[model samples]
Target: MSDELTAKLDRIPDPKTGKGLQAAGRLDGVAVRNGVATIVLKVEPDEAIDRLKADIESAAREVDEVDRVQIITTLQRPAGGGRDKAAPRQASAAAPRPARQIIAVAAGKGGVGKSTVAANLAAALAKAGQRVAVLDADIHGPSIPRLFGLRDIKGLRKTDTGIEPADAHGVRVVSMGFLTKPGQPVVWRGPMIQGAIQQFLNETYWGDPDVLIIDMPPGTGDAQLAIAQTVSIDGAVIACTPQDLALDDARKAIAMFEKTHTPILGLIENMSVFLCPHCGEPSEIFGHGGTRAEAEAIGVPFLGEIPLTIELRERSDTGRPVAFDDGPVADAFARAAMAMLDSAREARKPAPEIVFSS
Candidate 1:
């Protein structure tokens, strides 16, 4: 049955490439179950998404066994290879948002719990009565959707104002994860990444939140450059583990923000230690105080340290941030959030003018 549907879909033309859907590689997958057909389509941004979806749905319904048709659309990587010469966009071209403060949470490399920190921080802020929005700009490795328990969201609604963000626990959420399937890889180029960031900032109606936390992708790469140059970032909070290798990358992240002139609010040391739940023994698994030491060396405030524990991981996996409830981890994140707010606002203050004696 699925094969028959695929053959039918193959006859439909893809608007972007001017070829049959299958020939253009637009038909990603087709499955039939319980008299319902599920079709996955890879789409380009400028293509007519609705028209293509309608065409495919109409064709799928013609099959005798298919009682309903559901189309899942995922973004395709932009065209162009190594020869492309376009430079990164300037800050003047960026679309502005109404959020009072924009904070970027970054990690020098992957596996550093950057997304976890960002989500918990947003939750903590929201719990404190501040309107918060989180833009999961991780692109290729967007985990904000899952951390917030919104993994099932496949798309967003477009109104006269802009794209509507998904709300979870009082925080407005926007992420590339919502558009793509679970475990699906985003193979976009650098230019595509920058463009997506612009769209998220410009097209999403963030509703004048008090704080906008951008969950930055691991490493100082295209996404980082895009956010730095595309918007007036109030400050950046760096997340890193307590290890030599992680610290090496953390330094690079700090340098990137410095070069971009984005204020470094502070450094957060995640996974500082592991406390045995049963025995209550503390273990410095990654070696402790590395991030604080680095923060002191760089003249930036050390926000706080997050201890590694089974509860923290369990809460993150189950779509409940530990910070939402009252616990030791929650307390630590709350403190970090308070420090970040203070540091960011202070950094935003204008330099005092010096008057020399005439």
Candidate 2:
């Protein structure tokens, strides 16, 4: 059966070298099983590598027994490549500092407390003595400035190297809200949005930090794809409420990540329950436990849950995330942040500097 799969691969030619992937020594290995195959391609990262991957997957699916295919891109270290002896990078005479792991806090829609989660997560990580930075990728509606209490401060400024992000509560932040007046909306096309996201990543003067959290825009849209293409994301945390609508959309979002081959760190159930102010009893205002069940169904970890309460809302509105105040909300965010750290660590891999975009 393995020989049959190899024969199928032999029929498909590599776009660059114009030889079979296996024969050309680019096919690292293949794992074929009951209707699922993971094709690992080992080659020098390049522009057309995405197309090559697609071609390889197409050939693998030709086997009548295979139903789904996954591809893991890996480093093809050149001859004599190692920490002690490596080739010079083309971008600079001196080697650039190694980048820290970047995690994107994403959601299926707006109003899911995504910004609040993102802001509090950054604060919690920072409080734990880790340097952190956040990029508000929600271009259409930037909320980091207000959440971090930097709305009054100047937005991004041009530095000699690139642009400078705002500082708040021990975390560096960059957002379109800082660029424009409060309540102003960003009206732009897809390409413009893509460019803005790229600039935030490649052009920001982000000194080496412990963790970089990107508050991805609501829903699976251009910003998500832009991030996937811009950098090698270490992991993504999908935020969702306990409502049925949110769970349905979250499933779709999970499918999107799966299709793109991005690792899902875990699922966070935000606003899991509403604490009654008077009776102090937990109420299922927006339903309850749906997100945890969804996470289990999808085979991802159920990171943690945050209850809906007035204190959490008030702190976020005042640009003082409960994470700084150290309350119930703070505890919730801290727990989720630590889980995210664990997930990122588990999913860590050696990625190349150049991304292969289609």
Could you say which candidate leads in TM-score? 1
lDDT of 2 at 115: 88
For candidate 1, write residues 256-338 as lDDT tens digits. Answer: 88888788999999998898999978899999999999999989999999988899999999998889999888999999999
The lDDT of model 1 is: 0.86
Total clashes in model 2, counting residue pairs 3 or more apart in sequence or in different chains: 0
Give the top-scoring candidate (lDDT): 1
What TM-score quantifies how close candidate 1 is to the native fold? 0.76
Identify the runs in model 1 with alpha carbons over 4 angstroms from their true place.
1-95
Overall lDDT per candidate, in order of appearance: 0.86, 0.78
- Report the alpha-carbon TM-score of model 2 versus the true structure: 0.70
**Lowest summed lDDT over 10 consecutive residues: which window, candidate 2?**
84-93
